[model samples]
Target: MALRLSLLLLLAILPCIVHPISAAANGRALAESVDAAFWLYEAWPRSQKPARARAPNGFAHHLRLGMGTPPLNSTFVFDTVGALPWAQCQPCVHCLPQEGAIYNPLKSTSFVNLTCPSAGGTGCPYNFSYGGDAFTSGYLATETLTVFGRSFKNITFGCGTLNQGYYDNVAGALGLGRGNLSVPNQLGVDTFGYCFAPRATFFFFGSPPQLVPNTIAATTPIVENPALPSGYFVRLVSVTVGPTSIDVPAASDLLIDSKSPFTFLEPATYALVREALVAQLKPLKEASSAACGAVGLDLCFEADNSTNATPPEVTLRFDGDANLMVSEYLVEMSSRRLLCLAMLPSSKGSFPVLGRRVLMGTPVIYDLAKNVISFQPVDCATFGATFAR
Candidate 1:
């Protein structure tokens, strides 16, 4: 049955402050208006962690938006390398239970089912495999998506009837990758940026937020990987622990992924980093394998709450002299006494992934038009207020 129609569809959207910029600063004559912005929340709540999934930071975060004409509110985790934006829909054939109300397309007058030419004009089917047996498949459809208070018409997205994997407790994921069907591309925006803070932060589309004057910033070229088209790869020259440098070969392509919970390094490189951190934290005793392994991490420690022992500062030197400095390496696990390394050894031979832990408090700008990714450190909470001004 279709939902009841109402004249007023209340929405929570923050309108971006529209301002003009000189061509010298933007490199373009006209500045793109900020289309939409939304606050981010952890996909997995801290209080409820299954024994097998014990990482304090599940590494996944989600945002909420309204869909359809009547406006059905939905939550979706953002994926930097994924292409399709999808959410669990009604008519569950083989689907995992989601946190909130499932989107019912039949109830949305603005929803349109996309057809496939190969399927004799029938509904187009979309399938995505996330490895480790995690996958989502269903028909593709278009809907009027509402973010904050703005409405975008005819946005294509997946109406998944079959989805499974470690999706946490969210409704679905928004693909912010480089594919044509991705949210940014669909919106016809060449620039987008996001600021991740511990609590609530903003993800902006179109032109990025104006950084304060003389803000410390870094910019690096985004390399294209032909094999993995959707990924955002940057050149990593070397890694340094305090004053000591870790031996990572020059110009290693590191994928900057926001969905992954922890940074993954090659086994050999991880060993050197671990040895350096271990030597620095001699006063703190290493945690038991049971405690560390529970969270799927190799290094952990039991630390005194009042102790002055601190994790060594780690630095990533990218090509073009762009450096990312991470201060805390060992974060509190489930309990105050247990602290686990935020990074991990890559499973088998996967490429190194730069995860969300190192990105927190850093505002990242993806300027696709310029083929550059820029970084600026800011208090995200304070920066959020600037969007309205």
Candidate 2:
């Protein structure tokens, strides 16, 4: 029910935060009490996890640790780092349960959560890495704290980033945000296994050798300079209902393909996740001319997926009570885009339409001064979609 109690509180509170202990008790558990409370970062954008299935920043911020009973205020997300230090985090395994945490309302924001056991959690120590979001893999640490009950103490948050589009030139190359150094280094994957370990990565524009040696898929989701014609894909057609979800264009859809034009994720299920990015859009602009018969199906998508575009899934007729909605965006063919989804959202339904390799691509970026263009499946690094630069 609610994804079955968020998978039973993520397997009963993820073993108190990755634990096992044996190797000489590892300096007696790091001198005594230092199990790194919590850490997770994957502010995704081009990685595709179903656009992180809701709360991917479509606006979410409701923190109330008690009054509203914050048993898990917004299902605190971001959990994927375990190559060791007691690994095994199938994306937090079951998720939902933190007391408070769930961000992703970009005007400014990209995060995963439990920065460090504050609030109802406790206190983190360390476990870092950086690099991943669309292609997968990233981290950060030094794990901060203070989440007991609002003692924010002049709040200060900064992790630069390394999981949602990788960014943290080592805090900006020693000099700190005084940035630039990177190299072929890219983003993260080597070192920082434990000392307590849960997950972390720090870069905040402060660059440096940003990890390497392979933590898992290190760096790969390029294309954003002006490269197209390859296949083009970075879309999210419809889905609305917001006071401010970045001016709002798509509007949070859920039509699912009235016929085949396509449009999904319309409140696809999200009690609370806050921020969990992932995408797979490209509808041209909703393909028309009567469903791409000729001056129509300009829709693109060739990785084998054929397309004629248009199958139905656009409902328009507003004003009466504000009843106009969408989720249609064109850019067709992954075999026409398919998605039925359901390992457990209620235990059934939605897993057909077929198509989601995380919005597959490798080179496609057209910004033209923010007209908006970005696509990357692994590499190609090109896309300039429009930014005329």
Candidate 3:
């Protein structure tokens, strides 16, 4: 009887030894990496705030995404700093005139309206307000989202029944913030990266997306402030223009927001930055007579694509020695042929913001696990080959 039992036990364990299950695979649900590019368009708003009106032609970056079953395609603002993904929905109490057809939940087989309890008890009704009086109020729901040939089911997002804002030619906004409902967190991925260029921008989502070797020049810790938990705040140490470096207060926090078209500094900080820039540009022979303050720009100079007319370099020094260099010409108004310092003074007394114009051509990576943001300058034309690895 003992010999028989031992033989049976050995046979039972033999199959387990032959094909052991992978612990890594069982640990997490594996999803394919997302690598996609989208074209950016210019959007001009009626408001003259520096954040809204800084773009010469009014820059608005959008991407096409498929939602619901049978996939109704619609364009959305690819906002990195927003907290929730939202789109115009049917049965509208008050809906803005969108560019494409509004998504009707009844049309999609996979549509499911989540109640307050089902959506983490955060309440079913949600409202979001952004710069330039852009506000969207609606119910929270879950639906299928398809992007870059990958399908994500049961994704929690907003179905805007009431929206009020200047969305331009897009149906809604896609949130990529570091929140529970954001794309990266919803996908259960710890890493996501994005690079913006003139014609198009590349966005990647997955576990450890490939980046060019030695491309990451600097990194800084991402702080979570209790007052504003949704925003990405990085400590800015100082700013240097030529030989002048203005030291910011240690308590000051800088927000890295992509939705804002132009950077905005604190009132005191803007004054110093403007003084330094003016002193540096006074000697330039190509400087034009255009009044900087006339057109709502801080500084305006006539400059073309000529190499000799290049602007000076402005350096932003963050915590941990993360230095970001901005070209002088980059801050200029492209269509107006005026080199203007694209940053303005913040009227709300909120933290300073580093906007899209300063971030172009830089590959910015948000690592959630490490709680750090890494960035480096790269030739965006070679992004395909560089990140293919």
Could you tell me how far off, in angstroms, the CA of residue 229 lies in candidate 3 after the best superposition?
A: 0.9
TM-score of each: 0.83, 0.19, 0.79
Prediction 1 TM-score vs. true:
0.83
- lDDT, residue 92, model 3: 90
TM-score ranking from best candidate downward: 1, 3, 2
What TM-score does structure 2 among the candidates reach?
A: 0.19
lDDT per residue as tens, model 3, 11-99: 11111110112212211332333332221122233232211111224465666778999888787887777777889998898788876
Ranking by lDDT: 1, 3, 2
Q: How well is each residue in 1-389 modelled by candidate 1, as lDDT tens digits? A: 11111100111112211111211222221123333433222322332311111123445766667888898876677788887678888887777766678888889999988765555676777777776778888887888877655677767778889888857676788888776456776666687877766665567766655677756467899988865677898987778986689868445677888888678877777888888888887788888888888877889888664176766678877777788877545677656478888898877657788888887767788888878887765666656666766
Alpha-carbon RMSD to native, per candidate? 9.8, 20.9, 12.6
Q: What lDDT would candidate 2 get against the real structure? A: 0.21
Model 1 worst lDDT window (10 residues): 3-12
Of the two candidates 2 and 3, the one with more favorable lDDT, higher being better, is 3
